[model samples]
Target: MSELNHVPRRPLIAAFLSLCCGPLGQLYAGRGKRSVTLAVVTLVLMIVAAPIALWIPGGHVSFKLLMFAFACWPVFLIVDAFQCARKARQQRLHWYQRWWLYPLVFLAYLGPVSLISELRTVFIAEAFLIPTGSMHPTITPGDRILVNKLGSRDDVIDYGNVVVYYSKGPGSPLYVTRVVALEGDTIEIRDESVFVNGKQISEPYAAFDGELPTYPNMVSMQPVVVPPRHFFALSDSRRRSMDSRMLGPVPIDYFQGVASRIFWSRPRQIDFSVSPENSQIGAIAWERIGMPIR
Candidate 1:
Protein backbone atom coordinates (compact mmCIF):
# COMPACT_ATOMS: atom_id res chain seq x y z
CA MET A 1 0.00 0.00 0.00
CA SER A 2 1.25 3.51 -0.91
CA GLU A 3 2.01 5.81 2.07
CA LEU A 4 -0.28 8.85 2.48
CA ASN A 5 1.23 12.20 1.38
CA HIS A 6 -0.20 14.60 3.96
CA VAL A 7 0.74 18.34 4.19
CA PRO A 8 0.24 20.25 7.42
CA ARG A 9 -2.13 23.28 7.51
CA ARG A 10 -1.85 25.65 10.45
CA PRO A 11 -5.25 26.92 11.64
CA LEU A 12 -3.81 30.19 12.96
CA ILE A 13 -2.14 30.94 9.61
CA ALA A 14 -5.40 30.21 7.77
CA ALA A 15 -7.33 32.56 10.07
CA PHE A 16 -4.73 35.29 9.65
CA LEU A 17 -4.87 34.98 5.86
CA SER A 18 -8.66 35.23 5.94
CA LEU A 19 -8.44 38.39 8.03
CA CYS A 20 -6.16 39.97 5.45
CA CYS A 21 -8.33 38.98 2.47
CA GLY A 22 -11.64 37.19 2.95
CA PRO A 23 -11.21 34.45 0.32
CA LEU A 24 -7.50 33.97 0.93
CA GLY A 25 -8.10 31.78 3.98
CA GLN A 26 -10.34 29.40 2.05
CA LEU A 27 -7.73 29.14 -0.69
CA TYR A 28 -5.03 28.38 1.87
CA ALA A 29 -7.25 25.62 3.28
CA GLY A 30 -7.26 23.99 -0.20
CA ARG A 31 -10.89 24.97 -0.90
CA GLY A 32 -10.26 26.85 -4.16
CA LYS A 33 -13.87 26.52 -5.39
CA ARG A 34 -15.30 27.95 -2.17
CA SER A 35 -12.74 30.77 -2.21
CA VAL A 36 -13.77 31.86 -5.71
CA THR A 37 -17.49 31.72 -4.84
CA LEU A 38 -17.06 33.77 -1.67
CA ALA A 39 -15.04 36.44 -3.45
CA VAL A 40 -17.60 36.75 -6.25
CA VAL A 41 -20.53 36.86 -3.85
CA THR A 42 -18.90 39.55 -1.72
CA LEU A 43 -18.21 41.73 -4.75
CA VAL A 44 -21.76 41.37 -6.10
CA LEU A 45 -23.35 42.18 -2.74
CA MET A 46 -21.28 45.37 -2.30
CA ILE A 47 -22.13 46.55 -5.83
CA VAL A 48 -25.86 46.02 -5.20
CA ALA A 49 -25.88 47.51 -1.71
CA ALA A 50 -24.69 51.01 -2.73
CA PRO A 51 -27.58 51.96 -5.05
CA ILE A 52 -30.20 50.35 -2.81
CA ALA A 53 -29.01 52.36 0.18
CA LEU A 54 -28.93 55.59 -1.83
CA TRP A 55 -32.54 55.03 -2.94
CA ILE A 56 -33.78 55.01 0.66
CA PRO A 57 -34.38 58.01 2.96
CA GLY A 58 -31.44 58.89 5.24
CA GLY A 59 -29.45 56.42 3.13
CA HIS A 60 -26.07 57.41 4.55
CA VAL A 61 -26.91 55.76 7.89
CA SER A 62 -28.31 52.70 6.09
CA PHE A 63 -25.21 52.55 3.91
CA LYS A 64 -22.99 52.62 7.00
CA LEU A 65 -25.00 49.82 8.63
CA LEU A 66 -24.74 47.70 5.47
CA MET A 67 -20.98 48.29 5.33
CA PHE A 68 -20.59 47.29 8.98
CA ALA A 69 -22.29 43.98 8.16
CA PHE A 70 -20.03 43.49 5.16
CA ALA A 71 -17.03 44.18 7.38
CA CYS A 72 -18.02 41.22 9.58
CA TRP A 73 -17.93 38.91 6.55
CA PRO A 74 -14.19 38.34 7.00
CA VAL A 75 -14.72 37.23 10.62
CA PHE A 76 -16.99 34.41 9.44
CA LEU A 77 -14.45 33.52 6.76
CA ILE A 78 -11.70 33.41 9.39
CA VAL A 79 -13.61 30.92 11.55
CA ASP A 80 -14.45 28.71 8.56
CA ALA A 81 -10.84 28.82 7.44
CA PHE A 82 -9.58 27.74 10.85
CA GLN A 83 -11.91 24.71 10.88
CA CYS A 84 -11.07 23.80 7.28
CA ALA A 85 -7.36 23.97 7.99
CA ARG A 86 -7.65 21.67 11.04
CA LYS A 87 -9.74 19.15 9.10
CA ALA A 88 -7.46 19.16 6.04
CA ARG A 89 -4.13 18.98 7.89
CA GLN A 90 -4.05 15.17 7.92
CA GLN A 91 -5.65 14.70 4.47
CA ARG A 92 -3.66 13.95 1.30
CA LEU A 93 -2.32 17.11 -0.27
CA HIS A 94 -3.94 18.25 -3.52
CA TRP A 95 -1.89 18.88 -6.69
CA TYR A 96 -2.65 22.64 -6.59
CA GLN A 97 -1.61 23.10 -2.93
CA ARG A 98 1.93 24.28 -3.67
CA TRP A 99 3.45 26.60 -1.01
CA TRP A 100 4.53 29.26 -3.56
CA LEU A 101 1.17 29.29 -5.41
CA TYR A 102 -0.56 31.02 -2.45
CA PRO A 103 1.52 34.19 -2.76
CA LEU A 104 1.04 34.18 -6.53
CA VAL A 105 -2.75 33.96 -6.15
CA PHE A 106 -2.78 36.69 -3.51
CA LEU A 107 -0.80 39.01 -5.77
CA ALA A 108 -3.07 38.24 -8.74
CA TYR A 109 -6.16 39.21 -6.69
CA LEU A 110 -4.52 42.31 -5.19
CA GLY A 111 -3.47 43.80 -8.54
CA PRO A 112 -6.97 44.27 -9.92
CA VAL A 113 -8.39 45.59 -6.66
CA SER A 114 -5.64 48.22 -6.45
CA LEU A 115 -6.19 49.29 -10.06
CA ILE A 116 -9.96 49.67 -9.61
CA SER A 117 -9.45 51.69 -6.41
CA GLU A 118 -7.05 54.10 -8.11
CA LEU A 119 -9.40 54.55 -11.09
CA ARG A 120 -12.32 55.29 -8.82
CA THR A 121 -10.34 57.88 -6.83
CA VAL A 122 -9.21 59.59 -10.02
CA PHE A 123 -12.42 59.64 -12.10
CA ILE A 124 -15.39 58.66 -9.97
CA ALA A 125 -14.99 60.42 -6.59
CA GLU A 126 -12.28 61.76 -4.30
CA ALA A 127 -12.20 63.27 -0.81
CA PHE A 128 -10.91 66.75 0.08
CA LEU A 129 -10.39 68.78 3.24
CA ILE A 130 -11.82 72.26 3.29
CA PRO A 131 -9.03 74.78 3.98
CA THR A 132 -10.99 78.03 4.25
CA GLY A 133 -14.35 79.36 5.44
CA SER A 134 -14.99 81.18 2.15
CA MET A 135 -18.09 79.07 1.62
CA HIS A 136 -18.94 79.59 5.30
CA PRO A 137 -22.50 78.93 6.41
CA THR A 138 -22.76 76.00 3.95
CA ILE A 139 -19.19 74.64 4.09
CA THR A 140 -16.71 75.53 6.79
CA PRO A 141 -13.00 74.96 7.43
CA GLY A 142 -11.97 71.52 8.69
CA ASP A 143 -14.83 69.86 6.78
CA ARG A 144 -13.83 66.77 4.83
CA ILE A 145 -15.90 66.33 1.70
CA LEU A 146 -16.41 63.92 -1.19
CA VAL A 147 -16.46 65.45 -4.66
CA ASN A 148 -18.12 63.79 -7.67
CA LYS A 149 -15.54 64.01 -10.46
CA LEU A 150 -18.05 63.41 -13.26
CA GLY A 151 -19.97 66.72 -12.94
CA SER A 152 -17.46 68.97 -14.73
CA ARG A 153 -19.36 69.12 -17.98
CA ASP A 154 -21.52 72.17 -18.79
CA ASP A 155 -24.66 70.10 -19.35
CA VAL A 156 -24.49 68.52 -15.89
CA ILE A 157 -23.75 71.76 -13.92
CA ASP A 158 -26.37 74.30 -12.89
CA TYR A 159 -27.14 77.09 -10.41
CA GLY A 160 -26.73 76.27 -6.68
CA ASN A 161 -24.21 73.50 -7.35
CA VAL A 162 -21.08 73.84 -5.20
CA VAL A 163 -18.06 73.24 -7.43
CA VAL A 164 -14.30 72.87 -7.13
CA TYR A 165 -12.38 74.59 -9.87
CA TYR A 166 -8.93 76.04 -10.55
CA SER A 167 -8.42 79.81 -10.38
CA LYS A 168 -5.62 82.06 -11.79
CA GLY A 169 -4.09 79.15 -13.71
CA PRO A 170 -4.59 75.43 -14.30
CA GLY A 171 -1.66 74.74 -11.99
CA SER A 172 -3.10 76.85 -9.18
CA PRO A 173 -4.81 75.37 -6.15
CA LEU A 174 -8.47 74.36 -6.48
CA TYR A 175 -11.19 76.70 -5.20
CA VAL A 176 -14.64 75.76 -3.94
CA THR A 177 -17.58 78.02 -4.90
CA ARG A 178 -21.21 77.84 -5.93
CA VAL A 179 -22.54 78.34 -9.44
CA VAL A 180 -24.58 81.56 -9.61
CA ALA A 181 -25.05 81.81 -13.37
CA LEU A 182 -24.60 79.55 -16.38
CA GLU A 183 -23.40 80.20 -19.89
CA GLY A 184 -25.21 83.00 -21.77
CA ASP A 185 -27.03 84.13 -18.60
CA THR A 186 -26.80 87.70 -17.37
CA ILE A 187 -25.50 88.05 -13.80
CA GLU A 188 -25.07 90.97 -11.38
CA ILE A 189 -24.44 91.45 -7.70
CA ARG A 190 -25.94 94.24 -5.52
CA ASP A 191 -24.11 94.49 -2.19
CA GLU A 192 -24.95 91.08 -0.58
CA SER A 193 -27.75 90.31 -3.04
CA VAL A 194 -27.30 88.38 -6.33
CA PHE A 195 -29.27 88.93 -9.51
CA VAL A 196 -29.43 86.54 -12.44
CA ASN A 197 -31.14 87.28 -15.77
CA GLY A 198 -32.75 90.48 -14.44
CA LYS A 199 -34.25 88.74 -11.36
CA GLN A 200 -33.03 88.69 -7.73
CA ILE A 201 -32.19 85.07 -6.87
CA SER A 202 -32.82 83.63 -3.44
CA GLU A 203 -29.63 82.42 -1.78
CA PRO A 204 -30.47 80.93 1.58
CA TYR A 205 -26.98 79.49 1.90
CA ALA A 206 -25.19 82.83 1.53
CA ALA A 207 -23.59 84.57 4.54
CA PHE A 208 -22.92 88.27 5.08
CA ASP A 209 -20.91 90.08 7.75
CA GLY A 210 -22.59 93.11 9.36
CA GLU A 211 -19.30 94.84 10.16
CA LEU A 212 -18.17 95.27 6.55
CA PRO A 213 -17.30 93.39 3.34
CA THR A 214 -13.83 92.76 1.93
CA TYR A 215 -13.61 93.32 -1.83
CA PRO A 216 -16.75 95.40 -1.34
CA ASN A 217 -16.52 96.38 -5.00
CA MET A 218 -17.07 92.71 -5.86
CA VAL A 219 -20.31 92.70 -3.86
CA SER A 220 -21.84 94.71 -6.70
CA MET A 221 -21.41 94.30 -10.46
CA GLN A 222 -22.96 95.71 -13.64
CA PRO A 223 -24.97 93.01 -15.45
CA VAL A 224 -22.70 91.03 -17.72
CA VAL A 225 -23.52 88.07 -19.94
CA VAL A 226 -21.68 84.81 -19.17
CA PRO A 227 -19.82 83.81 -22.33
CA PRO A 228 -20.16 80.50 -24.14
CA ARG A 229 -18.61 77.62 -22.17
CA HIS A 230 -18.24 79.89 -19.15
CA PHE A 231 -20.07 80.26 -15.84
CA PHE A 232 -20.14 82.60 -12.83
CA ALA A 233 -19.51 81.38 -9.29
CA LEU A 234 -19.67 83.00 -5.86
CA SER A 235 -18.76 82.07 -2.36
CA ASP A 236 -21.55 81.70 0.21
CA SER A 237 -19.60 84.00 2.57
CA ARG A 238 -19.66 87.02 0.28
CA ARG A 239 -17.84 89.20 2.82
CA ARG A 240 -14.58 87.30 2.38
CA SER A 241 -15.14 85.51 -0.95
CA MET A 242 -12.99 86.18 -4.01
CA ASP A 243 -14.99 84.66 -6.80
CA SER A 244 -16.17 85.33 -10.38
CA ARG A 245 -16.57 89.04 -9.71
CA MET A 246 -12.87 89.17 -8.94
CA LEU A 247 -11.52 86.36 -11.19
CA GLY A 248 -13.99 86.79 -14.07
CA PRO A 249 -16.23 84.03 -15.47
CA VAL A 250 -14.72 80.57 -15.10
CA PRO A 251 -14.18 78.46 -18.20
CA ILE A 252 -15.83 75.03 -18.30
CA ASP A 253 -12.40 73.41 -18.43
CA TYR A 254 -11.48 74.97 -15.07
CA PHE A 255 -14.01 72.88 -13.16
CA GLN A 256 -12.81 69.77 -11.37
CA GLY A 257 -16.04 68.43 -9.90
CA VAL A 258 -19.14 69.13 -7.78
CA ALA A 259 -18.92 68.93 -3.98
CA SER A 260 -21.10 65.93 -3.07
CA ARG A 261 -21.15 65.49 0.73
CA ILE A 262 -19.44 66.35 3.98
CA PHE A 263 -18.14 63.01 5.21
CA TRP A 264 -16.28 64.30 8.28
CA SER A 265 -15.47 67.53 10.15
CA ARG A 266 -13.67 68.76 13.25
CA PRO A 267 -12.67 72.09 14.73
CA ARG A 268 -9.15 72.96 13.63
CA GLN A 269 -7.51 73.54 16.98
CA ILE A 270 -4.53 72.06 18.82
CA ASP A 271 -6.42 70.94 21.92
CA PHE A 272 -9.55 68.80 21.53
CA SER A 273 -11.16 70.03 24.77
CA VAL A 274 -13.55 72.73 25.84
CA SER A 275 -12.18 76.11 24.78
CA PRO A 276 -11.68 79.22 26.92
CA GLU A 277 -14.82 80.65 25.33
CA ASN A 278 -16.69 77.47 26.31
CA SER A 279 -16.93 76.38 22.66
CA GLN A 280 -16.07 72.81 21.70
CA ILE A 281 -12.77 72.96 19.88
CA GLY A 282 -10.79 70.28 18.06
CA ALA A 283 -13.63 67.78 18.52
CA ILE A 284 -15.42 65.95 15.74
CA ALA A 285 -18.55 67.73 14.51
CA TRP A 286 -20.92 64.76 14.42
CA GLU A 287 -23.79 66.68 12.84
CA ARG A 288 -21.70 67.55 9.78
CA ILE A 289 -20.79 63.98 8.99
CA GLY A 290 -22.64 62.39 6.06
CA MET A 291 -24.34 65.72 5.26
CA PRO A 292 -25.20 66.12 1.56
CA ILE A 293 -24.10 69.37 -0.13
CA ARG A 294 -26.61 71.40 -2.14
Candidate 2:
Protein backbone atom coordinates (compact mmCIF):
# COMPACT_ATOMS: atom_id res chain seq x y z
CA MET A 1 0.00 0.00 0.00
CA SER A 2 1.10 3.63 0.63
CA GLU A 3 3.64 2.56 3.24
CA LEU A 4 5.42 0.33 0.75
CA ASN A 5 5.60 3.12 -1.83
CA HIS A 6 7.58 5.77 -0.03
CA VAL A 7 9.39 7.70 -2.70
CA PRO A 8 9.70 11.40 -3.62
CA ARG A 9 10.01 11.78 -7.41
CA ARG A 10 11.52 15.25 -7.49
CA PRO A 11 13.71 16.06 -4.51
CA LEU A 12 13.56 19.69 -5.55
CA ILE A 13 9.85 19.29 -6.19
CA ALA A 14 9.24 17.67 -2.85
CA ALA A 15 11.52 19.99 -0.92
CA PHE A 16 10.55 23.31 -2.47
CA LEU A 17 6.85 22.59 -2.39
CA SER A 18 6.94 21.17 1.11
CA LEU A 19 9.19 24.04 2.12
CA CYS A 20 8.23 27.37 0.47
CA CYS A 21 4.70 26.39 1.32
CA GLY A 22 3.43 24.25 4.16
CA PRO A 23 1.71 21.13 2.80
CA LEU A 24 0.61 22.35 -0.61
CA GLY A 25 3.21 20.39 -2.54
CA GLN A 26 1.96 17.17 -1.08
CA LEU A 27 -1.57 18.36 -1.72
CA TYR A 28 -0.71 18.90 -5.40
CA ALA A 29 1.05 15.57 -5.71
CA GLY A 30 -1.98 14.02 -4.07
CA ARG A 31 -2.81 10.56 -5.45
CA GLY A 32 -1.61 11.39 -8.92
CA LYS A 33 2.11 10.74 -8.55
CA ARG A 34 3.98 7.80 -7.05
CA SER A 35 5.56 10.10 -4.47
CA VAL A 36 2.31 11.80 -3.62
CA THR A 37 1.37 9.23 -1.01
CA LEU A 38 4.49 9.76 1.09
CA ALA A 39 4.18 13.54 0.66
CA VAL A 40 0.64 13.42 1.96
CA VAL A 41 1.70 11.29 4.90
CA THR A 42 4.50 13.73 5.71
CA LEU A 43 2.14 16.70 5.54
CA VAL A 44 -0.38 15.05 7.83
CA LEU A 45 2.29 14.14 10.33
CA MET A 46 3.63 17.67 10.14
CA ILE A 47 0.20 19.12 10.87
CA VAL A 48 -0.24 16.83 13.85
CA ALA A 49 3.14 17.87 15.17
CA ALA A 50 2.50 21.58 14.61
CA PRO A 51 0.48 22.33 17.74
CA ILE A 52 2.82 20.49 20.04
CA ALA A 53 5.61 22.62 18.68
CA LEU A 54 3.70 25.82 19.38
CA TRP A 55 2.56 24.59 22.76
CA ILE A 56 6.22 24.01 23.57
CA PRO A 57 6.49 27.81 23.68
CA GLY A 58 8.91 29.76 21.45
CA GLY A 59 11.97 27.45 21.66
CA HIS A 60 11.72 23.85 22.72
CA VAL A 61 12.59 20.65 20.90
CA SER A 62 9.04 20.14 19.69
CA PHE A 63 8.79 23.75 18.63
CA LYS A 64 12.10 23.56 16.80
CA LEU A 65 10.96 20.44 15.06
CA LEU A 66 7.72 22.11 14.02
CA MET A 67 9.55 25.14 12.79
CA PHE A 68 11.77 22.90 10.69
CA ALA A 69 8.76 21.06 9.35
CA PHE A 70 6.90 24.27 8.51
CA ALA A 71 9.96 25.63 6.78
CA CYS A 72 10.71 22.46 4.89
CA TRP A 73 7.34 21.88 3.16
CA PRO A 74 7.41 24.86 0.85
CA VAL A 75 10.71 23.67 -0.60
CA PHE A 76 8.89 20.61 -1.79
CA LEU A 77 5.96 22.64 -3.09
CA ILE A 78 8.14 24.86 -5.27
CA VAL A 79 9.97 21.91 -6.70
CA ASP A 80 6.68 20.13 -7.35
CA ALA A 81 5.20 23.12 -9.12
CA PHE A 82 8.25 23.46 -11.37
CA GLN A 83 8.24 19.81 -12.22
CA CYS A 84 4.50 19.68 -12.76
CA ALA A 85 4.77 22.62 -15.16
CA ARG A 86 7.66 20.98 -16.91
CA LYS A 87 5.75 17.75 -17.27
CA ALA A 88 2.69 19.55 -18.48
CA ARG A 89 4.78 21.30 -21.12
CA GLN A 90 6.39 18.07 -22.29
CA GLN A 91 2.94 16.58 -22.50
CA ARG A 92 1.74 19.60 -24.47
CA LEU A 93 -0.51 21.01 -21.79
CA HIS A 94 -1.55 24.58 -22.63
CA TRP A 95 -1.40 25.87 -19.02
CA TYR A 96 2.36 25.45 -19.03
CA GLN A 97 2.81 27.90 -21.91
CA ARG A 98 1.38 30.72 -19.78
CA TRP A 99 4.56 30.68 -17.63
CA TRP A 100 3.26 33.23 -15.05
CA LEU A 101 0.27 30.99 -14.19
CA TYR A 102 2.52 28.69 -12.19
CA PRO A 103 3.43 31.30 -9.60
CA LEU A 104 -0.16 32.51 -9.43
CA VAL A 105 -1.40 29.08 -8.41
CA PHE A 106 1.41 28.76 -5.88
CA LEU A 107 0.57 32.13 -4.34
CA ALA A 108 -3.10 31.21 -4.05
CA TYR A 109 -2.24 28.13 -2.04
CA LEU A 110 0.17 29.99 0.24
CA GLY A 111 -1.73 33.18 1.05
CA PRO A 112 -4.94 32.02 2.81
CA VAL A 113 -3.36 29.55 5.24
CA SER A 114 -0.32 31.66 6.27
CA LEU A 115 -2.03 35.04 6.55
CA ILE A 116 -5.43 33.96 7.91
CA SER A 117 -4.34 31.49 10.55
CA GLU A 118 -0.87 32.84 11.43
CA LEU A 119 -1.28 36.63 11.22
CA ARG A 120 -4.83 37.03 12.47
CA THR A 121 -4.24 34.24 14.94
CA VAL A 122 -7.72 33.02 14.25
CA PHE A 123 -8.82 30.02 16.31
CA ILE A 124 -8.58 27.17 13.86
CA ALA A 125 -8.26 23.62 15.19
CA GLU A 126 -4.61 22.80 15.19
CA ALA A 127 -6.26 19.94 17.08
CA PHE A 128 -8.93 19.11 19.70
CA LEU A 129 -9.33 17.53 23.16
CA ILE A 130 -11.81 15.15 24.81
CA PRO A 131 -14.32 16.71 27.22
CA THR A 132 -15.88 15.31 30.37
CA GLY A 133 -18.97 16.34 32.40
CA SER A 134 -22.76 16.38 32.25
CA MET A 135 -23.17 20.08 31.70
CA HIS A 136 -22.32 19.11 28.16
CA PRO A 137 -22.85 15.49 29.13
CA THR A 138 -23.71 15.16 25.49
CA ILE A 139 -20.04 15.66 24.62
CA THR A 140 -17.41 14.73 27.17
CA PRO A 141 -14.09 16.58 27.24
CA GLY A 142 -12.18 13.40 26.59
CA ASP A 143 -14.23 12.55 23.51
CA ARG A 144 -12.18 12.91 20.34
CA ILE A 145 -13.62 15.63 18.08
CA LEU A 146 -12.61 16.99 14.71
CA VAL A 147 -13.20 20.69 14.21
CA ASN A 148 -14.22 22.46 10.98
CA LYS A 149 -11.77 25.36 10.77
CA LEU A 150 -14.11 27.66 8.85
CA GLY A 151 -17.45 26.76 10.42
CA SER A 152 -18.60 29.62 12.63
CA ARG A 153 -18.92 32.66 10.42
CA ASP A 154 -22.51 33.60 11.00
CA ASP A 155 -23.52 37.15 11.90
CA VAL A 156 -26.53 36.06 13.89
CA ILE A 157 -25.78 33.69 16.76
CA ASP A 158 -28.55 31.17 17.24
CA TYR A 159 -29.70 30.08 20.68
CA GLY A 160 -29.90 26.53 22.04
CA ASN A 161 -27.03 25.00 20.11
CA VAL A 162 -23.56 23.56 20.50
CA VAL A 163 -20.61 25.74 19.58
CA VAL A 164 -16.85 25.32 19.65
CA TYR A 165 -14.94 28.57 19.88
CA TYR A 166 -11.77 30.43 20.87
CA SER A 167 -12.16 32.17 24.25
CA LYS A 168 -8.98 33.57 25.86
CA GLY A 169 -5.01 33.49 24.70
CA PRO A 170 -4.16 36.07 22.10
CA GLY A 171 -7.38 34.12 21.52
CA SER A 172 -7.50 31.42 24.18
CA PRO A 173 -9.35 28.64 22.38
CA LEU A 174 -10.58 25.14 21.56
CA TYR A 175 -13.89 24.07 23.09
CA VAL A 176 -17.20 22.43 22.18
CA THR A 177 -19.73 24.11 24.46
CA ARG A 178 -23.36 25.07 23.90
CA VAL A 179 -24.78 28.50 23.20
CA VAL A 180 -26.89 29.69 26.13
CA ALA A 181 -27.79 33.18 24.93
CA LEU A 182 -27.40 35.29 21.83
CA GLU A 183 -26.25 38.88 22.07
CA GLY A 184 -28.99 41.10 23.60
CA ASP A 185 -30.60 38.08 25.20
CA THR A 186 -30.94 38.54 28.97
CA ILE A 187 -29.96 35.37 30.79
CA GLU A 188 -30.38 34.76 34.49
CA ILE A 189 -29.05 31.79 36.44
CA ARG A 190 -30.68 32.09 39.87
CA ASP A 191 -32.04 29.60 42.34
CA GLU A 192 -31.21 26.78 39.93
CA SER A 193 -33.15 28.26 37.03
CA VAL A 194 -32.49 29.93 33.67
CA PHE A 195 -34.39 32.77 31.98
CA VAL A 196 -33.44 34.31 28.67
CA ASN A 197 -34.86 37.65 27.59
CA GLY A 198 -37.42 37.23 30.37
CA LYS A 199 -38.28 33.80 28.92
CA GLN A 200 -36.54 30.50 29.75
CA ILE A 201 -34.94 28.40 27.03
CA SER A 202 -36.00 24.75 26.68
CA GLU A 203 -32.94 22.68 27.39
CA PRO A 204 -32.95 18.91 26.95
CA TYR A 205 -29.24 18.66 27.80
CA ALA A 206 -29.08 20.01 31.39
CA ALA A 207 -30.06 16.87 33.28
CA PHE A 208 -28.50 17.95 36.58
CA ASP A 209 -30.54 18.13 39.81
CA GLY A 210 -29.65 21.61 41.14
CA GLU A 211 -29.44 25.26 40.20
CA LEU A 212 -28.42 28.83 41.11
CA PRO A 213 -28.25 32.06 39.13
CA THR A 214 -25.08 31.41 37.12
CA TYR A 215 -24.90 35.06 36.02
CA PRO A 216 -26.94 36.74 38.73
CA ASN A 217 -26.26 40.35 37.80
CA MET A 218 -26.52 39.96 34.03
CA VAL A 219 -29.57 37.76 34.33
CA SER A 220 -31.42 40.12 36.69
CA MET A 221 -30.86 43.22 34.61
CA GLN A 222 -33.69 44.42 32.31
CA PRO A 223 -33.06 41.56 29.86
CA VAL A 224 -29.52 42.33 28.72
CA VAL A 225 -29.13 42.31 24.97
CA VAL A 226 -26.25 40.41 23.46
CA PRO A 227 -23.91 42.70 21.52
CA PRO A 228 -23.87 42.26 17.77
CA ARG A 229 -21.87 39.17 16.81
CA HIS A 230 -21.16 38.16 20.43
CA PHE A 231 -22.52 35.00 22.07
CA PHE A 232 -23.12 33.88 25.65
CA ALA A 233 -22.00 30.26 26.03
CA LEU A 234 -22.14 27.86 28.96
CA SER A 235 -21.48 24.24 29.75
CA ASP A 236 -24.69 22.18 29.76
CA SER A 237 -23.66 21.86 33.43
CA ARG A 238 -24.93 25.39 34.19
CA ARG A 239 -23.77 25.52 37.78
CA ARG A 240 -20.11 24.56 37.98
CA SER A 241 -18.86 25.62 34.59
CA MET A 242 -16.60 28.67 34.21
CA ASP A 243 -18.29 29.79 31.04
CA SER A 244 -19.83 33.16 30.13
CA ARG A 245 -20.38 33.87 33.82
CA MET A 246 -16.66 33.59 34.29
CA LEU A 247 -15.17 34.77 30.98
CA GLY A 248 -18.01 36.80 29.47
CA PRO A 249 -19.22 36.24 25.91
CA VAL A 250 -17.32 34.25 23.31
CA PRO A 251 -16.06 36.59 20.60
CA ILE A 252 -16.97 35.60 17.05
CA ASP A 253 -13.47 35.99 15.66
CA TYR A 254 -12.07 33.56 18.20
CA PHE A 255 -14.01 30.88 16.34
CA GLN A 256 -11.69 28.55 14.50
CA GLY A 257 -13.56 25.39 13.68
CA VAL A 258 -16.88 23.73 14.38
CA ALA A 259 -17.05 20.28 16.00
CA SER A 260 -17.07 17.70 13.26
CA ARG A 261 -16.32 14.13 14.33
CA ILE A 262 -14.31 11.77 16.45
CA PHE A 263 -11.92 10.27 13.96
CA TRP A 264 -10.42 8.13 16.69
CA SER A 265 -10.65 7.50 20.45
CA ARG A 266 -8.96 5.31 23.07
CA PRO A 267 -11.44 4.77 25.86
CA ARG A 268 -9.55 1.58 26.65
CA GLN A 269 -6.25 3.46 26.79
CA ILE A 270 -4.51 1.02 24.41
CA ASP A 271 -7.21 -1.16 22.88
CA PHE A 272 -8.68 -0.43 19.44
CA SER A 273 -12.44 -0.58 19.18
CA VAL A 274 -15.36 1.07 17.34
CA SER A 275 -16.95 2.60 20.43
CA PRO A 276 -16.86 2.49 24.19
CA GLU A 277 -20.53 1.62 24.50
CA ASN A 278 -19.67 -1.47 22.52
CA SER A 279 -16.05 -1.35 23.74
CA GLN A 280 -19.34 0.38 27.15
CA ILE A 281 -18.77 4.70 30.13
CA GLY A 282 -15.26 5.19 28.97
CA ALA A 283 -15.04 2.28 26.57
CA ILE A 284 -14.52 4.08 23.22
CA ALA A 285 -17.65 6.28 22.67
CA TRP A 286 -18.35 4.60 19.32
CA GLU A 287 -21.55 6.46 18.35
CA ARG A 288 -19.59 9.69 18.26
CA ILE A 289 -16.46 8.42 16.55
CA GLY A 290 -17.27 9.60 13.02
CA MET A 291 -20.31 11.78 13.60
CA PRO A 292 -20.41 15.16 11.81
CA ILE A 293 -20.75 18.66 13.24
CA ARG A 294 -24.37 19.73 13.51
Question: What is the per-residue lDDT of model 1 for residues 163-249, given as tens digits with 9 covering 90 to 100?
Answer: 988997589989999998999999987876888998999999988853465564566788889999998999998766679888899
TM-score of each: 0.80, 0.49
RMSD of each: 4.6, 13.6
- The per-residue C-alpha lDDT of model 2 at residue 27 equals 42
Residue 22: error of model 2 in Å? 16
TM-score of candidate 1 versus the correct structure, residues matched by position: 0.80
**What tens digits encode model 2's per-residue C-alpha lDDT throughout 1-294?**
122232334435534655555444434333234344544454465455434432344333434455567666555556655565344332322222233544665676455555544632344454466544423456654565555444346733456656666668344645567787876676776544577877776777775534444555423333445677778876776554556766777777765555544444544331123432332235666455544333
Residue pairs in clash, model 1 = none
Worst 10 residues of 1 by lDDT: 269-278
Supply candidate 1's per-residue lDDT for 38.
Answer: 83
Error of 1 at 209 (Å): 4.4
